[model samples]
Target: MNRIYLPLAASLVLIVSLALVEGKMRDRWGTPGVEAAELGKRFDQVPKKIGDWVGEDLPVEEVTRKTAGAVNYVSRLYTNSKNRNTVNLWLIIGHSRDVCRHTPTVCYPSQGFRQTGDPLKHHIDVLGEEPAEFFTATFSKEDPSGRHLERVFWAWNHPNTDIWEAPDNARVHYGLSRALYKLYFVGNVLNDENTIDSSASVDFAKLMLPALNAALFPEKIADTVQSDIQPAGDAPAEEVPAE
Candidate 1:
């Protein structure tokens, strides 16, 4: 009788401790100034034209959208004007728990695609800011038509920080955030490409980062200066011309 009651009491204590930790985490990370709906609206402002890539909206099925659990999302195809290569962009914002669970690794397999190799972490240099990090993976599907290959790069960032990261566990990493944004750049692989460094998706990301930052965090953009203009007293005196 003593042994049975002791084990049960310990189990209850463990359960309650876990609950308290979760509650504190939520209180710290889930309190953003902007609501999820308001942040979702900003997705509309992300440009349709970024550098040489011209974009057009892609229709997302109602059921598919609901399944993703995104409060807001944008699915579009951006085509390069010169090379004619195309990359698909999917951006979503929602609760971290919902947004983080459905990564390409999970969804692609469910759709009959097989992972080709272990995912790799890739970094993209975003001008005027720190290099953005993403996880890249390749998947292939076989159908009657033939084999189809896709390379996908994905990352998540909090609205306030605007710093993209590829975490080993996004759900746990962002569990406290009020809302989270997830971005994906998917491009078709042609001719069994060996490297993703030169992929159109990567090139497009380089051009898209600044535009995305401007749209999603306009206030931050306003605070940054593109030029090197110095304050009145900060400028050095000009030298007079010698006769």
Candidate 2:
């Protein structure tokens, strides 16, 4: 009875140890759950390769949509009221990936990690469908003197869709080298801290941009761009009588 009991105890201990090891492995590499449609021997494949890298598993877990959070910014058109320019309620959704994006605007910036980039990545939030008149822009992490970080106002006037060489128009490069000395630089924003947030929302347009398609706006552009046509004198009325 002693010999049988000893073997059984050792077996039980070994089973417990193996279970512990398996649990740790699952936690580190994540057991992927599969869709109902793919149920089969293949269903196991997802869990097996979940946290695995190309061949071996990665050190960190793979970040997914579940790990992400989103926020919005509304950049306004400084120009016309009737044909106001507006950002398409820009979304600064945070994911494991270091990137910024918007859906309707179809613009994206190859933003780096939150640790180094804009504070808005963590502090701000996406605007809801409810109408809003103001944009929420904040840069508390940046230097109070405004010399260190770039603001979003530059993004409002010069966008990623620059008709020039800048193909990546959506991504606002906050490089200090060229931008530092400019009016839009961080220094200028600090000089007038009062309007920093509302600068993008101000209606600075001299006139409304021409409506899209002449058929749609009719001769509105003609009225705006082209001068009014004046009538010529009757028809040389008494010129023959004077001759």
Candidate 3:
């Protein structure tokens, strides 16, 4: 009888302890870390034109913003003047890495797009910066009119570095960070071979990543510029203010 009671008592104690810990974590995560109103200038900093691609602001639904807990975000359609290739770029910034919870792997399927295969991880190298990790996938869907294919590329900028990373690594590194950003590029049109063409998405990323770095990590940009200034004649550029 004593032995039976001892194991039961231990189990009860362990359950209560685990419950208490879970409650504390929930409370900590519930605290408001970043507010959307505080990032009012995020949209203004993103340029309308990068290289030859012209961007037009695209509206984001309020319900979607609330669902993602976005501090600030931009949805834009960028079209290349030369090739007429188009990519929809969506950038979401949130106070917590939880923002990455709604990645294309989850969202596209819910929106009726069937994923073609497993997402492939690629080290995307921008022209002027070190390569960053991203996940790319091709999704296909059919509508009343016809079938469509979209190539989706996504990454999250963790708190430790400006380079974007896979969602798993982003969660491990930035799970409790004060701020994080997610970038997505969706290429809508398939090529003649009926495959999603990623040239447009790749080209747009190469052109836009530098500008994104400036907007997202202005402090780091300032530091780099100051360090690179020549002692003879050049002066440090004015610092880009942040919230």
TM-score per candidate, in order?
0.81, 0.21, 0.77
Clashing pairs in 2: 71-125, 71-126, 72-125, 72-126, 78-204, 78-205, 79-205, 160-169, 160-170
Query: Which portions of model 2 miss their true places by more than 4 Å?
Result: 1-136, 140-149, 154-188, 196-221, 233-243
- What tens digits encode model 2's per-residue C-alpha lDDT throughout 1-243? 999999999999999888775554333343332211122222122211111111122232234222221211111212223433232112122221122223112211223211223323111111221111221233323344433322432222112121111113323342211101000111112334464443322222101111111212233436645555554653454656655
Q: For each candidate, what is the lDDT? A: 0.86, 0.26, 0.76
What does candidate 3 score in Cα RMSD to the true structure?
8.5
RMSD of 1: 5.0
lDDT of 2 at 135: 19
In the range 5-24, model 3's lDDT, one tens digit per residue, is 99999999999988775554
Flag regions of model 3 displaced more than 4 Å.
1-31, 35-40, 167-170, 192-198, 230-243
- TM-score, candidate 2, is 0.21
Clashing pairs in 3: none
For candidate 1, report its TM-score: 0.81
When 2 and 3 are scored with lDDT, the better candidate is 3
Q: lDDT score, residue 38, model 3?
A: 51
lDDT of 1 by residue, 15-124 (tens): 99898777754544455324666899999899999788899999999888777767788899999999899999999887776778899999999999999999999999
